[model samples]
Target chain A: MGKQVPVAEGVFTWPSDEPRLIGSKCTDCGNVMFPTQSGCPKCSGQTTETVELGRTGTLWTWTVQGYPPKSPPYAGDASPKTFEPFGVGYVELPGEVKVETRLTVSDPEHIEIGMEMELTFVPLYTNDDGDEVVTFAFAPTAS
Target chain B: MTTDDVAIVGIGMHPFGRHEGVSGMDMGVSAVRTACADAGVEWSDIQFAFGGSAAAGNPDTMVSKLGLTGLQFINVVNGCATGGSALFSAYNSIKSGMFDLGIAIGFDKHERGAFRVNTRSSGLGDWYGESGMALTTQFFGMKINRYMHEYGISNDSLARVSEKAFRNGSKNENAWRRKPLSMDEVKESAMLSYPLTQYMFCSPGEGGVALILARADQAHKYTDTPVYLKSAVVRSRRFGSFEVMAPSVALEHNAGPTVDASAAAFEMAGIGPEDIDVAQLQDTESGAEIMHMAENGFCEHGEQEHMLAMGETEIGGRLPVNTDGGCLANGEPIGASGLRQVYENVLQLRGDAGERQVPNNPKTAYTHVYGAPGISGVTILAK
Candidate 1:
């Protein structure tokens, strides 16, 4: 088996069939934040608990990133001839938070606001060491 | 009632466009000199200076170029709101009776293309940079898309905004994109992000602007046409307001920064949106202008389509906006973008805006600039 690495550690649960994005829920204010938080941003509450986010969400808004963005931090393949456009949006997890995310679909016509989406892992790119780099994205929930 | 009254005695700016050989420092010097000349004051006569820039180096460098005057010089950086923030600082300095005459300058020379923001500097985690969602244009495209869907705005409204920008830009010699673009041309332009064409987005270009401000009582000594600064307010986003650079948003929806900034400005100026005769707004993209119109209380939600259709935002229209062309035509030089709005409004108030001047002798003008992560700065000026 090849070595698999997450795009960023601690963002989502790993090595599991049912991985969920990690978030923090303030015990004092009930405010939730994605990728967890050291303290509540709203009420400055220190008593917070890390919780797994919902696996499914509704697409709040989306757009097709037709052009290759500037690189440095952007590790995606950006060569115009080979570059593939992709979808980006904010997905509202019920009663939690609206998380900005990448979508599995690139075609704008295929996606609609309020559409049901399920979180899944996808390969962002591979590093020189032959580790498969994976990141999270949302796709149409299998009906 | 006029305790905090400040006045802009003079204003100057280098034309907005590509200046192949010119450095930002040289542009800054030129603008400062022009402003001093316009105010009929010598550089030595200036008491203090506050400068704003993102890409450019220390503004204290101006002291070496202008003259070695033992004056307090402060440099500030607040993303795209740098200019307005600098002006706010200057306004407060005079209002506090700390200094009578001070200058606020904004200058930058950015590499052509979409602005590359340093995620670390902007206080984002490494995960955000790795997600490939750090692009500003993508943020704009996403927010504007949702806004369009919720408000029933058509693609035509976006194109019309760009069309009007270029049309108004053609008359302003200082504008970068002076060639008028028809609605069809804007629609047919190459798509950058979904529903946003290349023409709809403003490029990051090079420019510099300077304003000489003084206490109202002393302003008449500098220039007879001193434009009174009624208010200069800057606000950051409240929780739940959507903005660029955030990885997530709160479930609650709070009024964004522009709303808060503009409202504070109107209250300070003791005027309403209807009282603004000519205006300049942040047009980083066509969609921003449409949304900002409603956000700043210039109109109500879903009224941009009808407002644009009726020519209410045109040069001679009832509420002439971006009269000297806006960021769409000026090409945003981040730090200088907000002050560029002030430069145009000053011209409009002084009846010096040549061909693009509004029909009626404009009295009050409003300017707003929004930056990353939901920061907005607003200023009101009166003749």
Candidate 2:
């Protein structure tokens, strides 16, 4: 295996057996935001702290991306010959926030609203540098 | 100042479709000329211009088509709310007595496929885009699925909305998709996203719309039946509202921009949703129309199913909506889409909508447009 690389830096921890999403928590309102924010969007309070979000969440809603999106940002292997649709949705991480995410399942029939899910890393694509580009997604938890 | 101080004296549009070999500027010129002719005013009479476009070039280019009169020509780009924002600007300018006659123009010619994502411009980091969550279609699908589950809205109801849109489009000569679709056909359309079929979504296309506005006192000088601008309000997202293109949402829910803008418009117009005779709400997708009906105070939550079942949203229904086929049939040309809503409302209010005209002469009309990451524009017009 060539080295592993995250699709983007600073969104989550990498190279760990168990990784969690990085976010910001408003010390005043206790509000949490993913991808981190400079300040609280709610109370507009400057006081905030970095925090790790919960790993488990429930499916708020979902859909199958039957069509491959336009390129540049979509660096996946989406050639018409090999393109396969996938499931995407919002996962409610309890009281933290509803994170928009790609689901592991591609079949809409297999997914249900309010289904339990857990955060996990998945290979988005390999870069020209021969490194595995990983991104975050939610998958059905065995529990 | 009161919104009624300004009035729409003229309205026109370049038919919504693929204008092969036609430049966006030419389409805009055509629309502007049509509006000026309809208003019985010469280009020299206009004092100010507000132009909006998305993929098309700067709106100031319109000065080349319509002679530059050394008047203010401001260009606007507010996602899908572009036209509505321009209209708002013109409304304020006229109401402030800064100009007696002003024009708002929206035109666009977009390349095919889903709207290209500009991660930087969208305020989304590279990770959000790389995760494949940036597509607007997925957002609509996900939001509608959650809405259906929470409100017990059925798939058939979703199909019914599309059916009505196409049926209404069939009578609109300017609409891109003019063929009526059966419910089964709509339901069986290719699945773009879960619970949302291909027919449920509106594709981006080429179009242009223009409106001529004047002080209410001077409107009769241009036209005998000027459509009064009762309200023109634009709103941004409030914290916690479910916004398409948002990377994440707050734990607590707040009213979306459509609700906020519509509420403000109703207050300004001095009319409730029930008081409006005809309406045009954003139908970026069929599900949006259903939810917007409730959001705009036209009906109660979970009341859309009953309304659809009773045929209350059809052309002859109690409150005919999207009488010009809406975005579903018009194909959303971003900048022009919002103003297209106003143009359709103006037609209905003037009793000039030929085949798709609402049965009773609609004196009051409501129009709304909602764009990504949370923004909404609403305008109420009266004859």
What is the C-alpha RMSD, rounded to one decimal, of candidate 1? 1.2
Tens-digit lDDT track for model 2 on B1-383? 24348899988789998989997777888899999999998888889999999888898887877887788999999998999999999999998888899899999998887888888898889777777878998888988898898897899998999999998999988899999999999989988888899999999999999999999987889888988998999999989999888878887989799999999999998989989999899998999999999999999888999999999988899989888889999898888999999999888888889998898788899999998868999999988
Model 2 CA RMSD to the hidden true structure, in angstroms: 1.4
lDDT of 1 by residue, B123-186 (tens): 7766676667888998889879999999989999999999999998999998999999889999
Report how far residue B123 has shifted in candidate 2, in Å: 0.8
- What are the models' TM-scores? 0.98, 0.98
The DockQ-based CAPRI class assigned to model 1 is medium
Error of 1 at A47 (Å): 3.5
lDDT string, candidate 1, A28-105, tens digits: 999999868778878889989999999998999988888877776777777778878889888999999998889999
In Å, residue A68's CA in model 1 sits off its true spot by 0.8
Clashes of each: 0, 0
